[model samples]
Target: MVTVILTMNLSARFTVQGSGFQSSRREKYGNVFKTHLLGRPLIRVTGAENVRKILMGEHHLVSTEWPRSTRMLLGPNTVANSIGDIHRNKRKVFSKIFSHEALESYLPKIQLVIQDTLRAWSSHPEAINVYQEAQKLTFRMAIRVLLGFSIPEEDLGHLFEVYQQFVENVFSLPVDLPFSGYRRGIQARQTLQKGLEKAIREKLQCTQGKDYSDALDILIESSKEHGKEMTMQELKDGTLELIFAAYATTASASTSLIMQLLKHPAEVMRLFTPISGGYRTVLQTFELDGFQIPKGWSVMYSIRDTHDTAPVFKDVNVFDPDRFGQARSEDKDGRFHYLPFGGGVRTCLGKHLAKLFLKVLAVELASTSRFELATRTFPRITLVPVLHPVDGLSVKFFGLDSNQNKILPETEAMLSATV
Candidate 1:
């Protein structure tokens, strides 16, 4: 057993060394010895059964150590590090704000924010860094949708810098040195906490009925109901925790989606073509060729590998949205195969909202503009706290002609009906 473990550890190390992304590590290892690792079983997850069990049955068995790296940045009791009934209660409270009704109410506001961000991009040089733009859009959305306030540009810049520092240290060696990234992350947490405390205090004094109807309202109301209202410190940490959760994941996924589309022009055109069948194809292509994730692992699903797996996709590596449209029934069993937001009980609570946000943004961008990758060479993929194209996704966006800008009445009607 020791020899088997040791060999597996060495193999895993070599695999990771060869591919910075975990999905690539799994692909390199194939189905052999999926278990075994070095260090404390930091995130010991395997197989779909194991994943389901941990995520659903014995979830508490898994520690929130992964987020401890951000504890200083997010408060200790922030939802990410929260456990047991408290976590569940908090989730329940927040769920109300994320419901379809709540989201629909916020749709017009969301559309306005997205449009403004896109308009800003329109005036810039044609080849814009889409990764950066996506981050900005998501960041702005988080503030407006969850915090109920618009962050000033200067404050947004400072906050993002601190956030970036904290994210960079999430997997760093568990040591704090003067001026090191981990130490900086700890300091950043302190700054964020102070800001959050002030905000919570202000919210506490507001007329109850006049409170902003964002996630903050839900959290405050829930805390009050339990007679365990968040203290200034708790409020600060919790807010940051929520923002980080929504921001980083969405930003990363959106960036990856765009990159995938750009890499396959045919798929991009097919995806945007006006056809009921084409829409489904875009969804499938997004699933396959986007990521490969192991069934039972509790880690973030690898959209890249899940998108490229041979068993789930015909030419898993190649971008082909048609597969999704034509093969929906065939891919039914593979629904859980491409979980960009994770799966089971722990699946992203904000998934529907995220999808709505993505769909609307995609509709707006594809319909009103023509865009393409400006670079001929594939940019190196970098894991900068989140996956990003190393060179940044520079693309030229051409505004649609007046006639081309005419909304597809059916599509507009569909979106409105959903709203």
Candidate 2:
């Protein structure tokens, strides 16, 4: 009967976090429970020890896995679509682009992009969706950093329209039937790939022994240096993956970050990270919290649950950035307790760059202008792929001059008081 009930709710976003899952967190179903998703029976591992083991034991115990729809979205030969040695090799090459030196080089460019974008938004003088705007900002940055092209704002906006089709179809049903979302995604992928190939060709032709300091150059250089040259197809696929990751994940987080900040207006929101969950296919029969997980069974970890429940986190739903302060240090619970950036060897490689982007954007916003929420209510958010406010939280923008560091005191107080 319990299995029947769990199976019923496993579809869609319910497996990891659907409606009413929280109420059942301590319902004696145990830490690791068997459930089904997309018609396949799987294990949902909510135990801290189980999460730690699967993450830490990446190779010996289990292999990295993703839903079929997700893999189709990420494309072939990308890190997210590969496992073990292949993933490691691609990661090594990709690391060069996200390296400290690379990110440092990218700062000035990103700042320019943000400054220009915000200035454009300031001219509107009305409520605007920060979530949608942030996607454009990140998209411009992604193109510049990944493909080594500083596209003009008009061209960038146009390109986003072209890119939007691909983005809409990523997690669609994986089938080649005509007029299907998957088919549309594949077509969009081809269109984008052709564009990337053209850019790569142009970049290569103009390389007169000059270092451009971008992902394109890094990838082109690393292909030969690592003893195994990446095929042009692989490079193109990786480029797509980079662009998607840079845009999608960060956009979602930025939307959520802004909403959270608005919620806690008086507090200094210091950091934000890509909070995600993933799949681990069991290599062999395993005992997790006394539950037998069979071979080839899908085991999904819930980052939401991990951070929401205690003895792990106190006042779980409360928004308190000071938990990481020197006095509290609440993240010291255990190794796998707080995983905003995930854990284990398969942890996100772009985490450093992501952190830098978010922190810098937050600082830029605070230092530049004072903005107020257009509405007092929180926007609806969907959690299937990433957490993002559905309506793209509207904000009234107000740009400041060089001398102005803060908004009017009354305005600031009112923003908080209304919430």
- For candidate 2, the per-residue lDDT at 37 reads 59
Clashes of each: 18, 0
Clash count in backbone of candidate 1: 18
Q: Please provide, for model 2 over 1-419, each residue's C-alpha lDDT reduced to its tens digit, 9 standing for 90 to 100.
A: 12212433356655245424633743556566667655567677765677898888787778887767667767778888788888888788888988988888776666655666666666665888987888887887788655766345476677687677788777666777999877888788888888777766677677554334777778767877888667778878878888887887888777766666676642222223344367888888766666666778788886666665536556766667777778887787688877777788877887787778878777777777667789877766555445556677898877787334332334312211211
Write the residue-wise lDDT of candidate 1 on 138-168 in tens digits: 8777766676644456877777776666666
Q: Worst 10-residue stretch by lDDT in candidate 1?
A: 274-283
If scored against the real structure, what TM-score would every candidate get? 0.75, 0.87
RMSD of 2: 7.0
Model 2 clash pairs?
none
